[model samples]
Target: MKTSRQNIEIEKGHAFVTIGMFDGVHRGHMCLVNNVVKLAGDTGGISVAVTFEPHPRMLLSGGDINLRFLTSLHEKEYLLARAGLDHLLVLDFNDQLRMMSACDFVERVLVGMLGMKHLIVGYDHHFGYGGNVNSTTLDDCAGRHGFDVSRVDALVDGDVSVSSTLIRQLLEEGELGRANSLLGYEYILKGRVVEGKKIGRKMGYPTANIEPDWQFKLIPADGVYAVEVTTGENLYKAMLYIGTRPTLETGGNRVIEANLFGFDGDLYGKDLTIFFKHRIRGDMKFSSSELLSKQIAKDKDETLQLLG
Candidate 1:
């Protein structure tokens, strides 16, 4: 997909667009994106996914909020590209854009800039100054701007709407199975390998300590997980730990470390992407390192079985 910072001119009335933070690009977001793509095809227009960088909440809160994201900008871009969008426009959610009124945003950005001939949005999607604009307002804007507006009904799983918020809650509670089902894919954490105390190596299960690439990227709940690890072109079955070393008495920050099965390498300073498959167990305070080692061995076995 072509990505743009500044709007490019498309043929007049040839852009089918959807707009949102698209945090996880979860199933719900995909519903709208896919709809836009289909609508573009039906209407002889180009499909465009318009998202903002740094998340509007981050800018609005002046970085005071503790909100974490399901996907970083890069990850979101990758997902949007894979979703078959014709173009991806990332706008800077700066003061000037934030200050624009609802009507102004519609006319200036969607109509004037994007050449939006048709707009597809989630059923309850809202935007513009303080997000006071609603679907009704969008319909009115469409009337004046000479375009069409369509709303995709919420995608639901067992009566609950599929949403990024719900997915985040599931991840926080380590409900990997449900979260992945709603997401239509496993949750991923991307990071670079950092040096650790080499305790896992001593335990005979070497691990690559991961420092997440994005400060706001949400790490799943503290636990051991069955994961698929990808570094460059290689994929490995792995067991991942996300917590402090309670048994080792390592009093420090929480760490993300992954032990790749049947693999040996120096990964320090390299990047690793982890796709969480299942929660093996929550963080535990074993009475001894020997006990912890045994538990890890159990986790590895369980991981192999799950992955297999």
Candidate 2:
């Protein structure tokens, strides 16, 4: 996919576009994006996806809010490129863009900049300041701007709607299966190996301590999880721990660590990606290091079975 940060002037009436933050690129987003691609093909126009950087919430709240994201900008770009889009335009979410009214946004960004002949959006999506603009308002703008609009219905699983918010909540609650089902893939965390206290090594279960690359990436709840670890073109079945070392006296900040079963390698400073498959158990404090070690062995056994 062709990607650009600066606006490019496209031929009038030659592009079919969709606009959203598209966090996670979950199943709900895939539904709308697939339609955009199909419509673009049918109309012989370029399929353009317009997204904002730093998330609108972060800018709107002036960095006061502790908002986390499911996908970083690079991850979002990679997923959208794999989804078969013709172009991905990343707009900077700054004060100037935020101040644009609903009508001005349509005329300036959609019509004037993108030359959008057709616009596709989610059924409940709203834009502009305060998110007061809806599909009806877009329809009015489409009529005045000489463009057409289409809204894709929400993708629902059972009674719940498939959405980024719901996925985040599920992950926080340690509901891995449902969250992965909504995402249509395993939830992933990417990071670089960092140094930690050699406590696990003494217990005969060495681990790689991970420091997430993105500061605002959403980490699931503190617990043990069955995960697939990817590093240097090799995949390993691993048990991941995300919590403070409660069994130790020096327990302080939360740490993300993983033990790769049946493998041994030096991973200091190397990058690794962990794909969460299942939640094994919640974090717990043990009476001694021996108790924690025994429990970790059980967790590893369960992880192997789950991965198999």
Q: Please provide, for model 2 over 116-211, each residue's C-alpha lDDT reduced to its tens digit, 9 standing for 90 to 100.
A: 899999989888877868767888999999999988999989998899999999999888899999999999899999998977888898999999
Overall lDDT per candidate, in order of appearance = 0.90, 0.90
Q: What are the C-alpha RMSDs, in order, of all predicted structures? A: 1.1, 1.3
Clashes of each: 0, 0
Write the residue-wise lDDT of candidate 1 on 1-308 in tens digits: 89899977688799999999999989999999999888888878899998898788898788855789899988888888888899998899899999888889989988899878998888888888888797778778999999998888999899899999999999999898999999888998999999899999999999999999988999999999999999999999999999988888668689999999888879999988999999999999989999999999999999999999
Candidate 2: segments with Cα more than 4 A from true spot: none
What TM value does model 2 have? Answer: 0.97
TM per candidate comes to 0.97, 0.97
